[model samples]
Target: MSIRPADSTSNPPPGSTSEATSEATSEATSEATSEATSEATSEATSEVSSEVSSEVSSEVSSEVSSEVSSEVSSEVSSEVSSNPTPNLDIREWIRIGTLEEIDKNGPMVVKGIVVFQHEGSLYAVENRCPHMGFPLHLGSVCDGVLTCHWHHARFDVCSGGTLDPWADDVPAHAIAVQNGIVYANPRPKQPKNLDWHLHRLREGLEQNLSLIIAKSVVALVNAGVAPARIAEVGIDFGTSERSAGWGPGLTILAANLNVIAKLDTYGQILALVQGLVHVARDSAGRPKRHMLQPLPATEFGTPRLQEWYRRSVEVRDIDGAERVLLTVLGGDASDADVADMMIVAVTDHFYLDGGHTLDFHNKAFEALAAIRPELRPQVLSSLIPGLGNPTRSEELQNWQTPVDLVSPLFAAFRELENQLGRISPATLASGTSDSPTDRNASSIDGSASSIEGSASIMPSQTSPLLTDRQTRTDAEKIVDVLLGDDPGVIVETLTALLTSGVDPVHLSGLVALAAAKRIVHFHTQNDFGDWIAVLHTFTNAHAVHERLKQSQNPLATRAIYHVAMRIYRDRFLNIPSAALPKSDAADRAGYSTDLRQLLALTDKQQQVAEAATWVAHYIDTGQPMGPLWNTLGHLLLREDAEFHSFQMLEAAIKEHEDWEKSTRSIAKDAMRTLVLAATRYLAAHAPTARELPQVARIAWRLARGEKLFAE
Candidate 1:
């Protein structure tokens, strides 16, 4: 992923890819990019910079300073936008004969360097324009400024600084005349520091320039900057700049960061870049958020703040919620307390924002963990606006009629709390509390108050289900019941687990395992959109798992019931559940374990079952997992995967790892479920226009001096 440094200042060469391939590389766009730009293809290619000399030859080795101007990544955008090149010549000083060999107003390219004589002075620069890889020789130089006719971006002759704010500074080379011999550096002077690259990364994000972003990503990562640091910048921008607050971009960023280490070098870079690109789009044209201050010191402790925060969220009061969150964060309340506050409120409404509320909350906290803990206030406050108005699932017809899941679940919560002897903060009655503490914990948790007088809905099977496990462990038995057809039994089984003093985290993990199974068992025979249904349940379970581990707050544990109810609603998707593909001796013959074949399965169409089949084969044969992880990463990184896909892959990986470490007998089966879940989800979204990964590939190849543009 690192780029080499060059001595002379010259334009870049195309990568080794074919002209047809590189031409399409310039057109990379995903479903996400198309919505962000009028012409995604054109917009992505418009910021190419010429820095090809860095990879001039394998022999000319100096191992360019890791500090070699971080902007050297432009070579990628510039080269790939054109045709691919096969041959490259490297030299410290490329001689251009004597003065007589140069024309008075000549625009001549020697070894990718453009030597020019302007105003009776000798100068040299890249043969192509720093913006879009257009031939610099085609445009006329006047008044000591280089202008690319394509975009009208103006650059200085000496310093290569941009005359226009929109265009980045061009790479300037060192030109000299000695002993009647004219010589120029093939490589342009690159920006010398990570800060410069970071600044450019911001610029790329600000203008939504894919070329700049592509280049900056290659440079910063190649320069050895930690992925978290880069993600922190995007995370900070995405949260603060978008008035809408915590959106898909940041979520994708957090999710990708969770599994980035499992990817190949190129995949790692692409994963991060994809996240940043989404962040840029999410915040594009949006005004920066005006942050609210925390309330002044008051008599309220963490419990009261928790109540007030939930109450504010319950009323859809953004300002009040933000103030309350900031107030709690500004006090001695730990991160756990902050998480409990958000989770209780999120669960207070069934599947708030279609489960995104909990997912975003989880991501925000995960994003916070990746950065400084001091960012807690800024990070947690962003969750307010999304909570202002979310689609409460309880009001939906399906959740209400066939099975009054809300009332029964609420009733179970009341009875469960009675046994546990703790008050919950989930409100059942549509009545708003006059004050934060006005309602008892039972009301806040939807436990004390009956849901339309439908109290007492505990599982009739709790007694027998716990004892007759078919030789399954307690965790396995609970998971089996969770994925079963009985909604009432599911609730009762969960209640029994919690009351039996089973660790709440273990229960939450089982719920997540059950949710993952829904995806594993999902049949393509069902509607395509149902994928999101299963995805929502798992992501919510993921958030619940994390929060439960953080704090076993009575209110936090309520989310488990909420997540289980969602799993029940998703039961229909598993009808005629897709069978796992098994590997027999014949199946292990040829290409069954091939990573390329697994990826190829995604290239054609929604190979949902086929992908799961491939993953199951890979795992069953005891093939190396590193390559499997790498291949799974390619499935997402290569497509125009939107928010949920990113969320699913990361969560699935985490869940799989969680199961692999468990002492349960079915842990192996659970791992296969998660792997298949992730693989199938990725397969469904695979083979998009593929414009997104093309950009990353081109950038990567160009940085490595692989051919990209024509000679």
Candidate 2:
């Protein structure tokens, strides 16, 4: 029997399993079948020899004498002569050959199995070998065994059993031959194992690809504009100390994309968390830095991003322990924000109540050790205070914050230090205090002397950088840290400065002004409050400069008032409502009495006036109330003298509003502005003040244009 190889044009070689072979063949079977049929038809119509026919002439003549016999023989002969034809639909079973007629080593692609008479019997079995799915037709048949052409997987000819230990049995086909014709039943079920393997393979591929894509999205965000802009800002401010100097921070982020993308896996995730912590540690620990790259993508500078930033800076609601822990356990948090973000990403594992949560905390602690060893103890202290309830404790401890993790935080802090250092007394002078003796002894143009003289004449021009005569006389206390002598004061001042978004340039200049005046050493204690207040003062100076330049009306007015309110809050030690409240009426009354006395100071009185001025500006001109109302509101409700002044203000605005409608509206606006400033001031410093029935009544009357309280 002539057999042809499974059409290479249609099917690839069988893979490790029959299923793979079938799938490949199915893809190309249509074209191969067409080619085979065409070849067979052409062969049938082509040349044939007459010599063999003559040898059987008598038999042929006899058969032809019977018309049916003649027709059947002719048809059979024609089919047999076809080049590549394997007749598939003949009803007559005619004995042709034995099973050994076709090779067993190779896969039986075509005409591979046969039926033949042996000892007056006929049997049939598939000619293809089972192992490796190879063609049995390509190998030699021996005795009752069939071996594949490729890997020699042997099988029995009769029972289709495998002789080789590793070989599988070939299937048997129902075969019979009659009237010089052969027939076969070729249907068989494929092996079950092959199907299962294919299914698993497909599933694995899909899962892996999905994971890859998810990771890529995260990496892309990290490598985009946010990081780039931060890097550029860092370089500009001389804070970027990353290797290779200046370019774009995104480039570094992009370089890590591969690592970031693989973070879905536990090992990869751990590596990423560790890597980020390491980078943050390096950034924070280093005292000096090299230039870094510019930001990528212009769109990152969207107004929405700026808006988000502005809003975030104003939010001071984070609880004390969390804040303290973040600082103590997380090492200042200025440079390691991104590292914190990385840790947050792995929190899902912990949140699910899986064992992975412990692992997550372990890794987190490890990171803390590597990057911010100093903060570990503090953070632990803060966390321990509230860890009694497991759920709440875990929620608190889990790193899941979604802050921008921008480089600006670290850069800003660095700039703060740099600005402070640049204008530090060590750089510009020898003494700490801006004393008259020190000023006279210095050759630096006596700018300090001039500033002091101006300050004496107009407390507003206490700032050495005043340009306007009106402002010089009316200039609010730009910074009053030097007015006292406390390091704690400096800390508070610095903290306030941070809140106001004080920029480096203005800070440097302000420091210079202070240094020129030799004012720093004038104080006795360098405490938290003093630093924080000084910071507020510096920030107010910057705010004033910005608002005046923009002059965007209501918005600028609002900004300026906020600065003024900060100044006011620091000027008087107005207790914040957030502080521990008094236990009873007696304690509350006692505290109130003492606070009243504190407000009676002359300096505090001046601060109240300054706050009033800002509120007056806003209400009369329909300008931004800013921080004025809020700042003065607390003072008014907290201080007896200041509270009395509100009644006077009410009368003045009422009398002023007795004019025409427009004039009355203007007057009302001015009064409202003043009230608003006071309200805002109270809100910040003494929220409970507004809760007072009397204070609320006054606020309600002012808001509603009623004059129940003198106005």
Candidate 3:
């Protein structure tokens, strides 16, 4: 039988000739036709010459036809023998003729696959390299190993295992041969889905493998997992894995959920991967804890639900508490309803772990609000771990002691909460609506040096000239006075300065600085957390100063003085003051160098003292304090500072602005005190040293008199 041409539209059957064989058949057919015509013409002439010629012609025609047919069959068979199993499927066995046909072609691509003949066996695999999708048909096979020519990624053709880790394993087909033909199933052995990917994600987190975490995140996201859900896994894993309760990693993870939503698919995956890495690293080798599981849904009114949630959290039944909250969330609860419930729960326990618990809960709701409503469930659910983690102050300390202050503090918090809407802005600040002209007109211009004019606010004495040396000496003396047993001495010294035409603003700073120093140096048995209040009071004075700058308000200054006195009263915790470092008068450039070097020092406590001494010297030498304030601003922004640190930094920045606008000695002194307080606070907090280069650049600019925050 004559071989037919291979059809391009349909898969070629086993043992079919190639396109080259078909072309050869066509040429042989044309030659055969010409030979038959010539023989017919010669036979007709012989027929006229003799009677036997007719029979001879008939025989010649039969012989010629047989010869042409045989030659065509032989050529077609030869070509067919060169290639075997041109189109083969693993699902069925293929008959591709004899082994000689496979040997002739060595290796051939069949149905977009490469089929190899090795040592009397046939193997088939995907033609594309797994590394970069390069075709494996161009690759060489030797000793059963297939090597991609492009990148030399070698794979065992028999097993489809990659030799290089960078190149993934090539997908091998299930091959079967019957009657010398080969077939293959192109489908992969095992198919992966969303569940599999999520499982891998958990595994990755458990093992702290970054690569697996990254792959799992991308896979889950591509498979349609919500970003919030991905974040939930990280939060849950982080909180549950660590024995020391929740840490900054979980907080950072939740905070970035809003940010992750705005990024592209890859960027989102990357951000989540980074967050997961942090959580895993932070929790690695830590003791594991049982995570709180959400309870069954229930129908309850908002008020009843809030009460139940608060009681559950108060009793430390966090699982039950979270279940109630989640149940409410599952229903028609509004964001406000949720926030109110959370706020009640958080506020139920005052000063929970230095107030970080409350701050985290507030931030959690804020972060939740930033996301779309649909994405809030998983994100909200993730917060259960943190909610259950706080160690309340009441649990740790005896509330019966006078110094415990827990009951009174909680009572104060409740009172403040109750009075929130009842107080008006005018009642709060006394003169918030004062116009620019009113404010500028009220600005003191050294015209009120006499004590009688401002007697109620300032003492009846001529304020001492706050020269650089005198200011330092007074600050040292104030610290000395504060360290003494008598609180009256501290108040009297501060009042005398206020009466000395010393701006109360400056006096506030000096008092705040002393309060800060007391806290820093106080090496007492009682680790009084009340120092936070003292620091906040000192920081708030800057606000009082700013308000009174635009419009004269003696009440603001008096309020600040009372707060300062409270700080003094608290200073008797028996903590001795840290010795203040003596300063050498350095020029502006030299001072800048000192500040920059101080920031780079690993000893943060010493850095604080150095920063304070440098700023004091700058003030004493009559150099502009704005650059020093600007330098601090740059330092504060260097890292992702804690919330409280930012609060102090922002207050300092505002104080700096107020000082820049006014050349009053009080502004200068207050500025100096605020700077010292800030440096000390920062020293305690010790912001991450990741921004040292930026700090250096900022210091250089400030030294040259260039504006830092010009806009």
Candidate 4:
């Protein structure tokens, strides 16, 4: 009787009838049995004399026959039966077809193995292409090369070595030819080890190899390596290898840690891929840094460890610094303690490399939190090279500042910290118990005062002295005054507008626009220090206006005034704003389309001016600002990665006001400022232009009634 392996399907081989299938199946069983018995007898006789060998041969023959008979019977029955059950054991060599049958079919797929005949030789490989998981059985084979139909990734049929770098290497299996039948080992070869994959990931980053980067990421993720660890390697390599020190790549990685973590497995991989590509591109052809060895582990308290870490970082001892950090993190140190230490270390020097060092430090901590605690040491180790080798010395202005702005800024931040206490900005505004003031009492008093004030300046009761048209005209004058030499006049105008029952929110919006103008017009050669401050003030004013929509807080007016005053003081440095055509008021759809179009412009100055004007126009037309905001929010989320971007985004999100109830003028001005800030960010960061289409799609979707914010 011929034996057929289990998992052999009932389907006839290509170009073979049912009769031929039965004949082949029976022949396989008989051949298997004969081969087994013949081998058993030969082994029995070779080991003993003829007289004793006869008895041994009988026993061996019977045993081999019984076992082979059972296997053959079961396999043949399954193959011949109408319903053939698949074999669960993938390691078993299943009979797919004869060599001639494989040749007739071109390639035969059996139990995930692709068995094909080339030049009278049988070859079997995993059915899936290594490049994109495309089916290889459908691919064409010529001159011993198998070419994937989709991406045209070519591979050697016999060796499974890929001709294309993007395809990597496909897993090929051993093929057994017995009795003219082709049997394939269905179990694919095991993938590369974690260390090997990690090495490839590093190579990808070093050489800016995208396909290798993608393959390594997938392999690592599939191997159960933590996403955080994978992300850390990319972050570390990008930051350390780049000659320019920290950059938008590191900032982008830091900014999107939370977003990346929340994405599905594939999305997370793609996010890392994009981030690593930026790092690689930024660092390509730059001097490569060698990894440092850690000092011997020693017992130290948190304070001592922190001191050691700081000292190590100060001396550019990458290994020592990371070991110290890892030690602290490995211990019972609280997250706050670790954060405090990191903050101190980063701030020890002012404007560390155009503020990138501080930004990277903050983002590192943020990214660190997303990782598993056990894996943090690995992540910290990866970041140490960048930390120790910052491009700080290259920033000569930071070192040779004529004025000591650093100390004053630090002092101001310290004062704010003291005032704020332990409560974060988010909790402070939301009336949490952690807030310094009594939430209920403050809300009641604030609301009552606001109600009383609004009654006096109510839209229904106010005179037509400052009509909507006049308010817009006055808002424009405020902008003109802001650009003028007289600071006192600008302040007076801002105060007058607020007191004259011109909507405070609207007035604040104008102040924000002026603040943003200060940023746009800023032409000083100062390092990243004061220029960033201008951006913060504008975003802050925008945040204040959003808060004012909910409650008429006196503090909101004060914040707006301060921002306006700052803009006025910086007027001497103001360059003329770009001469862009004014946009006409349009419907939400039209405006959304316009925003997308503006974002595509290669000229940053033009993009910023046009976007700001368009937003102002939409607001002036009294269209709902929520959808526009939603669109802006999406763009920020996708591209903005700088510390300032985070601050602006945070401020935009903190305003828990009903957008629909916001005064049109205030909403317009506030949005204009916010959009201008976003445009400035895009100008600086220069995120991939390919993302524009996706951004446009999101904006269009919102216009078509999709939720602005996904739950």
Q: Specify the highest-lDDT model's number.
A: 1
Error of 4 at 52 (Å): 46
Q: What is the C-alpha lDDT profile of model 1 across 97-170, one tens digit per residue?
A: 45556654366666566776676666666655545555676666899887778788887766677777555676
**Candidate 4 local lDDT, 284-357, one digit each (tens):** 88776544444456666787787777666656776677667777877777876766555445434333444445
Off by over 4 Å in 3: 1-206, 209-246, 252-277, 285-297, 369-375, 386-389, 395-404, 407-589, 593-605, 612-711
Clash list (residue pairs), candidate 3: 89-184, 90-183, 90-184, 90-185, 439-550, 463-500, 463-501, 468-620, 522-575
On TM-score, the leading prediction is 1
For model 1, where is the 10-residue window of minimal lDDT? 1-10
Q: If scored against the real structure, what TM-score would every candidate get? A: 0.81, 0.18, 0.40, 0.51
**Residue clash pairs of candidate 4:** 1-30, 2-29, 2-30, 3-28, 3-29, 506-666
Q: Candidate 4: lDDT over CA atoms?
A: 0.51
lDDT string, candidate 2, 165-254, tens digits: 444456554443211222233322122132222232222222322122222222222223222222222222211233321111211221
Compare candidates 3 and 4 on TM-score and give the better one: 4
lDDT of 1 at 278: 92
Cα lDDT of model 3 by residue, 408-455, tens digit: 232222233233433233222212242211122233211223122322
Q: Please give the ranking of all candidate structures by TM-score, highest first, separated by commas.
A: 1, 4, 3, 2
Kindly give the stretch of ten consecutive residues in candidate 4 with the minimal lDDT sum.
Answer: 451-460
